[model samples]
Target: MADAPLKVDFISGAVDYRRRQGGGRGQALPKALGFRKGVTPDVVDATAGLGRDAFLLASLRARVTLIERNETMHRLLAEAMARAAAESPLHGEIIARMTLILGDAREILPSLKPETVLIDPMHPPRGKSALVKAEMRQLRDLVGSDPDCAELMRVALACTSKRVVLKWPRRAALLPGLPAPSHQIVGKSTRYDVFMKLPAPAGHS
Candidate 1:
């Protein structure tokens, strides 16, 4: 029996994001990723779940690299990118600015250079009333909780020259073992913790 083709739809999804809210720094993610007028730093989305955020970043004119470790998710993301490029005019340009990689970010981060690294590891499920979105529930069922998120954060901090942004539930406690974020951008349902790397002191080896 033939397996069903993945039906992930990033084109319409990104359009919805742009149409509903005007995709820009006003959004929590772009704000946390340091998106500024005339400045679109290249970024790596370490946990490129469904590529929603990656697509958003690409639309904002940043070159984005999406990394997904889960084989199933990677396959779906790849198919989604292909479909968007073929079907959506905006996505043609978005696809040009985006790249997809298959591997665990901890292994790949050391080899790449990006201005910002975005990590949105799967956290514990939300309360009963605030049940997770359908897509998120499917992801959770497939990938389970991210147990190595702390290590992933460490690798991102070491490799990234600018900052690392982590998407987390607004009410959940910060991920343990990570230093306090330099600042945060809060949204209605989620918050982004921004950790800016300290500049090396002059004349210091």
Candidate 2:
């Protein structure tokens, strides 16, 4: 018989990620994005290298669409997600909501329609305190730098029906030609650049 799925450890910060977040138990996704209270939004995680962010989103009850291009990384993410689903108490219901896709974000993002599109491309870390984590280093080995991320941004901006939030280092420059974002949420080492879409044409509900 096949081996049982791996066990996921919620403690030790083993399965938690900094970027991808699920709905907090007592907390909810920010209300501005139309996320119903206690209801997770369907998220398209375009760069699912290690699935850390994706897993966090799942933990928060967000229905995540994880996209990865590297064959090996894809396999690892699938295994990890499976392990978490089977072993995590909070994941029983969350797993059903996540969908994994292996391909370029540029190709997958255009085909998906979610309340939000979250992008976390690999950029240079600013300081020693901002160094990449060990897990992220492993992922970097699997998938190199996101050199084509500018193009991916273009595609995401065009395809997202609601908003596109790019997670970037606070010091990093905006994607080429992109204007200042409608909103920005800054953290210690990272910032979420939120671009809201033009409202749907009037008279169309």
Candidate 3:
């Protein structure tokens, strides 16, 4: 039989586990997005698949807007978030920090700008990602292959004033034709390529 259809449960399971595990500014995601004491920036999760990163940011006290382009996935995320919100005071508090938008990110991303934008571009699974493979397949099922990630990258770059973070497999090749990142934060299996807005040239403004 085909793998079981994905069921999103934000209240319990891995979501809850992560919520209770706790984190700090030194974590890869937070550090890449420039998190610091007393500086929890508003963030836009451009490819808000499953709301994992978005929720993680919210759990860290960032106001996060999650833009998911797929209708089914959006509905699933909406339901999961609603359930989580009603589950308990803690989950409700984090859910309150997240706002979900359904539509093509490239078309709507410019309007709902946030200080830091996060994109986890979808690519074919490369190696032994057994534990993560299910979610990867769910991503393929939910959004299919993302041919427009580069365009979304462009939109994110144009609209974000602070920074845009692209999450990629640590060893994977960077997307072609894009400018180099201002810096990168690499972990064991993942990396975040951070592109910050260029400062105005002298006398330009």
Candidate 4:
């Protein structure tokens, strides 16, 4: 069979610098998702986008796999990773721990077993003002709607052995019909809905 094509773009010097900075002064979703202390489980970032969240998870020591369906975003993220690996000492180690996948989460999420699966589908912007970052607006234009978000959530919940966390706008209703989160946290403009899986049976190790 023909090999699946590579999805990410070649890393640019500038963006690579930013990725190594690893969320730097930017607002990171992991912190707001109540994973502030870091995640001990393996994680899959279903909406990888610019990879800020994935980078943060890696920095926090989670073995993270970043999934981006958009070829453009994948390329951009790849370029950023490349830049970081070349310039920053800590960058290479972090990049070593992250796996980048280019595909729909529905197709990918089921095949992997992660301790946690994270979803941060882009919601329609509440405003056309300056508060929304230009890069984010551009990203929305490129990736479009999260129409499959509900389905993606379903697959993630079934496949993950630990938990599935959904990040939503604070005002939006919870995803239809999934078990309510085992817990939740309201951030400045968003909320994290955590769904926990049953624990492993004793001596099943």
Per-residue lDDT for 148 in model 2?
A: 89
Against the reference, the lDDT scores of all candidates come to 0.85, 0.70, 0.85, 0.75
Q: Which consecutive 10 residues in model 2 have the weakest lDDT in total?
A: 3-12
lDDT per residue, candidate 3, 31-143, as tens digits? 99989888999998988888887888898989999888888889989999999899889889999999999988888878886678999978647776665767668778678
Candidate 3 regions with alpha-carbon error over 4 angstroms: 127-132, 201-205
Which candidate, 2 or 4, would have the higher TM-score against the true structure? 2
How do the residues 83-131 of candidate 2 rate in per-residue lDDT, one tens digit apiece?
Answer: 7678656665666777889888898776675568888888764467345
Model 4 Cα lDDT, one tens digit per residue, 115-178:
6889999885776556886666677778997888998999998888877888888888887877
C-alpha root-mean-square deviation, each candidate:
3.1, 5.6, 1.8, 6.7
- Please give the distance, in angstroms, between residue 148's alpha carbon in candidate 1 and its true position after superposition: 0.7
Error of 4 at 157 (Å): 0.5
Q: Which RMSD does model 1 reach against the true structure?
A: 3.1
lDDT (C-alpha) at residue 181 in model 1: 97
Clash pairs, model 2 backbone = 20-53, 21-56, 21-57, 22-56, 22-57, 22-60, 23-60
Report backbone clashes per prediction.
0, 7, 0, 4
TM-score for all predictions? Answer: 0.91, 0.79, 0.92, 0.79
lDDT of candidate 1 over 1-205, digit per residue (tens): 4334335677665445673477776677888888878777789999988788888888888899999999999999898888878976777888889899999999999899667999999987767834666666677778789999999999999888899999998888988898999998888878889999887799974
